[model samples]
Target: MARPTLLFCGLLSFLLSCGERKHIAIWEYPEISPSPEVQDYFGTTVIDSYHNLTDLEDSLVQNWFKTQDSLAETYFLNNDLTTQFKNRFHELEGRTSGEVRMIRTDEKGNYYYLRYDEDKDTDVLFYREKGGNLETELFDPSSYTNEKQNISYLEPSYDGTKIAIGFDPQEEFTSTIAIYDVINKKFLKDKITHINPDFGEIEWLPDNSGVIYLYFPFVEKSDPKYKKHSFSVVYYLGDNPEKRTPIFGWDKTLEIASDYYPKVKIGSSLDSYIVGYAAKSGIFYDSFIAKITDVKLGKPNWKPFFKASDKIYYNQGEIREQYFIYRRATPNGNELCQVEIGNPNFNNPLILATGSRENPITQFEVTKDHIYFVREKFGVEISIFKIDNQVNITQLSPPFVPGYASFFGESVAHNNIGIGMDGWTSNYIRYCINDEGDFTNESILDSPQFQEFKDLVSKQIMIYSHDGVAVPLSLVYKKDMKLESNNEVFIYVYGAYGESMSPFFSPTYLDWVKQGGILAFPHVRGGGEKGEEWHTQGMKELKYNSWKDLIACTEALIYKGYTRKGLISLYTNSAGGITAGMAVNERPELYTSFIAEVPRMHPFGLESATTASSTSYIEYGTIKDSLECLGLIQMDPYINLKQNKYYPATLLMPSNSDDRIPLWDSGKYIAKLQKYNLAETPIIMDIDYKSGHENSSNYDAAMDVNARIFSFAKSNMRY
Candidate 1:
């Protein structure tokens, strides 16, 4: 008689023996209709078979998504892990107090911030006056409408008499501006719609009579140019929003492209001049300044302050007295500079503080007495420095170190600044820095202390890539946990737009370490970890460096005996899709599973006439040029998939209402993977019908998705 075969293998047994027989679930992928389409990119013919899946409006695509969602649900139900993870996640979340963000203090010492309300299950705007013990509920999204809404942005007038709040419906990009009278305790009748606050803030005039903001012409998502052709307009109190005057845009006298987004910047309420500029994705753009009086008269004479040829990145500089204090790009790094506002000279300016590659200046603020700036080293350690009128720099000794720090609030008038600091093992704290350089705890919210995270440890190590480049990799796990080949590792990646994976605390991440798992964060080339040079090495024609760096980091983990092959998982979202997707495609045996949320798997799709494509062409090359088209093809994950290849299990979470990345990118990529992969692993696409590119604001909805992700990772890594 033959020996009885085991249906499921134990974790210890599977880890001890490489030949252990583990039961792997072979999912029956849903059948998708193939609508073959071919495109010629400078004589290069690329054929796409699952082009029909891009049309989410099609009935066949809709049914296919439903079927995939059902299959994923059944898999999770059969494994019986989602509920366990959900309960554990909730327990971990309950251990912490609500979060507070966008904290602002007016000249009158009134504090305004958005705080998460446990009872309301959403963030609520709260206001507290000077020397007040009680906080007042200024605006509640729950009270506004039955549908879920969020306060995207808020700005208090210079006089602290009125507040401009941008209210955005959940899963939508457009926002409406509403003015609230702080003294009167009521909202104004004038309502401004079709406003895009993400591009800029609500800049108030010196007298606080109105606000200057970025405006969008189209309000309906069905419009072809819904988020395009944005212009800066001024809306006055008690005036019709339809009659708002356009100050700066491509249609105006300004020399800006149609795809360039225009924004207005008012340094201070006392300043007489305002700055205007047009940018594609970054701050390196041509900027101009004009007198507020001339702008109000609709006959402004715009003078060039900085041109795109200068390669200067805007940092919200201030206009003090007769001089404009700002930071400009230098060969070494960023340097502080000041020029006369009346007759600005870009060719030369007074340099105050200089930065080096090791400690580059990240943010700065101007005050009546001094200029304060923050610098970072290797994206981990932060230092706050102040420059005197004599160009002397002094580093302030804050209580927090080995963390991130940023300056906020109006420091020019009050001579007081708000500093936010947080680290990987520590929670976020707000401090008020006085003119005398004294740090005071100004946090209004309190967080609960959890014992489970007491033993958590984070280590920063540099791993050499295949090309001999040292990539910074961050590891987080229990301090007493033993490092071995059988350890389960989860690697998170997002290496685009020069965004850095800075240190920040998250209870959800801690929950993973609280269990016996290792969390890894690789500061790859495309990010701003090292500086602009690091980003340049991983973008456009050099895009392969990003994924190549990830592969090196993953292999280093296995070689270092921290983890083994088929025991690690890779996860990423949005533009980082290029990094994670390509890594898994190149070496599928390294990871047990892959998870992507709202991923940009198809880079060629960025050539379409969409807002995402227009702004992103600066980061990722466009298909219009032959050289750039070849680069886009090389980085396109969907186009690089191979048939008869063993691919790890993949779970793709995409929202139908995502305005940033189209659903087609995820749809087509997963459809082809499910059809071509030789492995029996599942390729699932879970669609969120009621959310956008930004994660869902609904607490339960976010928890549900996170639970599924963790559960899927756990189930796959068990073998």
Candidate 2:
């Protein structure tokens, strides 16, 4: 059963009887006045025609969206090809799920996890005790609110009596944090509201008295400008839960040029430790150590732990014994360092693990006897290693696995570590390391039959970019498939925020490959695949390199006879959406179909918007800067499209509830693109009202979205 608009059952019936694409009428777009807004940016005159569309609440824009939805509904419902693709994707998705594995284990031997119940068609949170036979259902998000609301973050207390869970209403940026009592399976009266949707890092005190969390006062102040600053607050969770005392923030008396509140993290063992980075930049940080024996006794004397300079960026660390094992960013890669708890001099900190271009520590975790870390090589493969205080490194995991592994959630005591891992040909699986040092793994959900992929082959290959850089591409396809230009291919890229799109398994991608299509993942610049140097090469003024790298990957695939022009489709979301939008705008001829989910389209328009966050300015510099302005204009997909040019069959998927990048961003971009495109190819804006930047883990919701996307892809292809 599905919504009337989705027409799930009707489409299934149509799919079973269909043989060819049906003639569906494509409605003409609603007429809107060409209200151009001109502005002078550093002596450059920029013209914006869809300025009126930016007002998402405007009657005109709302009416336009309704009309577009009506058109899409009619076109998709009537087209037999749409039904066919939906059925195929639905079947494939039914056999697999994006199961949320229990990422953390508490000292009390409790393992908290989330999984989709196929019978219920929703995701449910469950926790099992160390020796318990039955798994207890902690939270069923669907029961709390509508299907759209899901548990975005869950952190259990050290003692396991309480747990902090963040509930995110789909499409909205803010989340509601509530404390839950484990034994009773009930929520406490205390609720912490207005958390930053992107960053909800919270640390519970060892005493279980309160939590240390980052809070932006935008909701309380109700001022748009207030969003620029976020401070750390200690909220005691007893009878007086209302008392939220600020721990670290704006000391106006201190004559410092930086923002008063930067992103900070707190941890405690023998003492409390905090690592803070200037919010203005994601790079460097300052550390403080305090004896937080009593969280309710106001504040304690904070001693200097390590004063971070511009050169070193603190990732994460913890205080164990008298030494601190922390990870810091180096020139080439991130390294693990050991320092005294209250070390006044930071220069003499001992290097526990020296990181380099060849062996970069992507992530690390602290244990009593040993420090466990993941080192990545060749930008795709990762291996786990552990080192003791004796400076001896031992390989815990095999040198190579099919996919990469990373920290899944908060770790529990007893040396138990949970990891989330997947590969191009692999399904998402959860692995656990027991106290005895044995690695155990289980599929997150009932994965699709792996036997189907026995004929498939996946590997990583290098392709030279425009600037002679060897960009890596991860590809998966049927081994017996002919390497001909006729083969259909799907390419994905996201090269921003130094966040790499790893070679992970996807049922959607596997469905395409199973249908004789090829899936290629371009490990382009702008991502941390090759470390910070690769990221810096494609950021700010050099942002074009990201899309350029994607284009180069496309060309190389075509040249190698994996696919031909007009046979390949590209997909990306968020920052990756920026990469996809830019690539399609620059080289429309290289692709037949393009899908951008919640894309960062016009940087100038985005920066000028009232809803834009000040913290985002660091990624793509402010508009006031001349070079940044020029780069934003050059990369603006809406502005760069040529009039009367034939673009690819484009799908712009934006979540109506997504506050991160407002729906209007995609709305305005689609409107401008539709006006400029004279070709018969479709430019569709598929808006999901129930999803957000982080899609739901619900099984049905996943099926619905995949059906829509895969159906569109199927309709655009030539048989």
Candidate 3:
């Protein structure tokens, strides 16, 4: 297997008078013998030449990836810009006290959370007492195994005597759940394997004697149904996991589809009933309620709580004594509603709180005395509100104004709540609200303030899209920076699955702004920035709105004198690649370069018989339907690439272990781009072998990746 070589042409000066420079290098891409394949969809024939790359077992494919990786290594070897970004990243990250998340509080006021361990370079589980000023180390992957592992999920028991922790070794999607005795300070004999920490819930029983969790039947990545057909099962303490039968899932009930994911939810305050829900990759869910006693006796009678047609939001509902509180999609907005669990009537439920288009309810949690929910005003400002037993709504004042806030780990038994808040310019801090509604700072660690971030400013503006739709765009830059077209700009986009691009503090953004670069975030239609309608407008047949909205925002920025056409870069990861890829394909002259990390570049490939295809057919649309097939073809970046067209320099980053979006997707896209690109700019594919879809757990490794991205964007700037 011969590796590709980089042919460095003579460096041409673009703006030597202004002291700005760029290297002109022509890269010799790896030679691939494409095995042409064709597929017919509703009388439309599509030809794919790089289809052989999908076979991971092919030696030719493996060699090609290795050659491409070597080419990237040779291109970035000892580059001064890369080294400068790496050093600045280290200086910025070292000043902070790491990060803390997944906070859970037990009934006895014991706090459990995952905190970053600077020495081990991984997040470790820590336990803090009610009034203690110090945190005690509870669980570290280094203590149990030599392999680097991460704490995927944590759920403390109701009685505070035991806790369940899900650990993913080496960033593998396959996780295992283990029980730890809080009082005894040791791990129990109970262990459940073949669990996915990202998809479902891990609920503890009311008596603390058992746990119900989502389990996957197939663990081998080679299996066609590797991440499909997930079901919920109960695991008793010290019992054999193989002997347990599923209490809710496709096999247990005829109501659930084989491809849909099933999960179980048990309220800590209620010992009588449990909730079971099944959903694909959409906001709507089909939910049912069953008695706990019947479930234990192995004759669970599942009664319909709500159907997908009812428009109930998944993972947004909580079970109270005899009532189920949830937020449902309405024409106005997402309405907070409650229904009787015994006789669930979703058609005419009791509306506790109603939201408008201007302020849509985003998240909610049910406590013993009240129900708390968070609302967002066009994805910019966040507000918290509460509803009492008498259905009286009141807005609660947070510690900070115009910041992101959400309730987490609310104990129904103790009526205690944890609120995590942060802004575009503020560091994340946690607050504990007691039963009497008093807020107290319960943060276990404090992040150091940097002068670079202190001098930064953020502004929210609305830009009209191609369809005359107003889309929210966020801008962050140095306070002293002027709106000059000469400045470099970076746009980050992720508008899919009804997820919003919310405000949060990050040192990486500050680093870019501190270097006199502007960062832009567009709240496109596919996201839940406005409401459910906003997401539906950009899905399936209307998916083109997402990329068009991004283009509109970018054009508006340039017209407003924020940055010039050739000085801007587009950055997107995962599903956001759809927007960025299509935007670049439509208007390549607007950007100097673009980076796609673990992106889903080929929508037609997603229709193949894979786990992602089955689970995500609802969001991306299935080829079984003619209309949806047309929509998928329209948004397909790989299929839309024109021959001999001028394109910006592109850096495609694909991780070897990313099961969500395999490396072959990026490999095929880059191959086509490199073959047809008319510009002298390079189309590079960088591979990360150790990580999956998520970033690396090792601090230095993650920093190195970020530095490469920053440097790559900087190197391509025309200036």
Candidate 4:
């Protein structure tokens, strides 16, 4: 064993406060004074007391936050049960199927890629010489002075002389971009700060003189017009950062064209055309394009790129010369459409490729010579193909693993197409496809040790919901494990944003499975698993479908004798937090415990959200609308929570610095739960001071969070 084994037998109750097990006392919650605030949505009056918690900058709220975090740290971290969980996690952390993500090569053929290194405790950037097999450590984010800071992105310049890296403190949404000299292996003094780490991206100029990126202002509260908006600027290396020229934003005319502000992105081609996306509603958007030369000259005659249509919620594409290859949302699936650059309207658009709801184009990449695309069938099997300039489609041959791949265009040799894959039950592989359609994978890193997982069984099952909708479920457990009502089970869900949960090997999850716990992933509606219609059915007014689907799945599991109510726990984060939180509140008896990390407790309470922008309103709908308010009232976990309820033992993980979802959402949620719950069920709030929704950047800190969560689930999930 890599770690000392602690006695875990009979200590489960001590770790998690299981029902009827009074071994652990319920600690008193921190005293929070209610500041009632009311709002009138048409005729309905909504009252809020813990609303003040949303004011993160308020002196009283800050003090309360500090006190609550301090109390949580002492209550959750400094304990024997946590130590045991950490040791157990360390035991399983080594059992991994390593992955390589975003493999790229510079003009000099120097290869660069990010590798998930368990031993290093953080993802490290590795560099390989043109033809060398030996990989050199280019950047290890874990070596930062502030242990919580981690590298978020890496963008190598055209000439490969400089690699622009963006890093941020863990869980937070702010990033700082620093230029690194690839030859010198050192970072430059120039740094670009106030970047919206999640959505912001950097692109180097063709000449390699500078880069174009976006940044938000450093203010306590953003201007309403500029809320969650980033201004694009061109930063020249070794030049004064403050002197960077702003190329985007300050456009009052463009704001009228779309409800949301547009962000700038440099196209993949050498044409140096700047693309802008202004999302009007949902996933559908209107885009604009302008040349780099015009923007540099301070004129920037922006022209309409993709015009939005009411029927299409998603219209995006890559600009290839005078033609634009677009993917538009269709009734059955996303279909590819093309239009000439100087077209007056999309009245005469040509359909290039068509797909159904089951076999949709998940992603597409445009290279100089070909357009590569990945088509997913039923969210399980994936197929890749390429289309040449003459519209000749060619499907690559066998050894096609079911996983995700990223294409990095053609290499310097132009004879091969650079590709990287994240496979199921396998390590990430980076290779190239030659003109002969043969894959030549270069060994850049060693495969992860997964010998222990050979005995585990992975299966896909379908459970019928209350409405008879067959929701897809993925289950993984030891082959010898028996299906029983007393078995501990964890259900993970993310029922929003059309995001599909792919089956990938995770040491943390494998550890749980190794310990006889069953892991389940329910591909419920609101995810892209079944396409846009599936997502639409579980969002906005129909949002209750997400939670209802979760409940139905849970009940189905219990009915099937997989696990009893008191033996099952649920885990959800980000938007899924809203789904899981609401589901548990609606059916508290169905779960033993719950973990909601960086949750959006109150979608209607946008005032409390960190990045409450116009874009979010499109997803959750505006609170000012009576119809939306009614739906929000029915689905918002914070609003639906009642006093004197015997809620399941719940752990709320919130970071103090998360700018995407905001920590205040969790603060106010913990306040309400503590004030309402009268049962001994622990409503523990584990607050990370430096982390946010994404959790800690430091591997140790992140592991601690996982240990606490896994331990709580293991302990509380006992009958």
lDDT of each: 0.78, 0.69, 0.81, 0.70
- For 667-692, candidate 2 gives per-residue lDDT tens digits of 77788888888666778777776766
Using TM-score as the yardstick, the better of models 1 and 2 is 1
How would the candidate models be sorted by TM-score, starting from the highest? 3, 1, 2, 4
In terms of lDDT, the poorest run of 10 residues in model 3 is 11-20
Residue clash pairs of candidate 3: none
Best by lDDT: 3
lDDT tens readout by residue for model 3, 1-719? 12244343332212222322477565567889878788888988877778888887889898888777766766566357777888989888877646777778787788898887788778888889987988888887678777656677788888788888877545467778888988788898888787776677678878877878788887677877777778888878888766666788847444577667788888674558988888678899888888998888767888777888888898888877788888998767699988888787888999988777767888889888988888898887898887877888888887786558877767566577788888888888878876556678875657577766888888889999998989999999888888888989988999998888988887876788888899999999899888898889889989999999999999999999999988998999998988899999999999899898899898778775454535666888888899998898888898788888989989988888886787888988998998889997868888887777865446777788888888888888996
Clashing pairs in 2: 102-113, 105-412, 171-657, 171-658
Error of 2 at 279 (Å): 3.9
lDDT of 4 by residue, 72-105 (tens): 5554544556688787676665444245665677
lDDT of 3: 0.81
From the highest lDDT down, the ranking of the candidates is 3, 1, 4, 2
> RMSD, each candidate, Å?
5.6, 4.1, 3.1, 4.8
Model 1 regions lying over 4 Å from their true place = 1-23, 77-79, 146-148, 250-252, 608-613
lDDT of 3 at 122: 80
Question: Clashing residue pairs, candidate 1?
Answer: none
Question: Candidate 1 at residue 656, lDDT?
Answer: 72
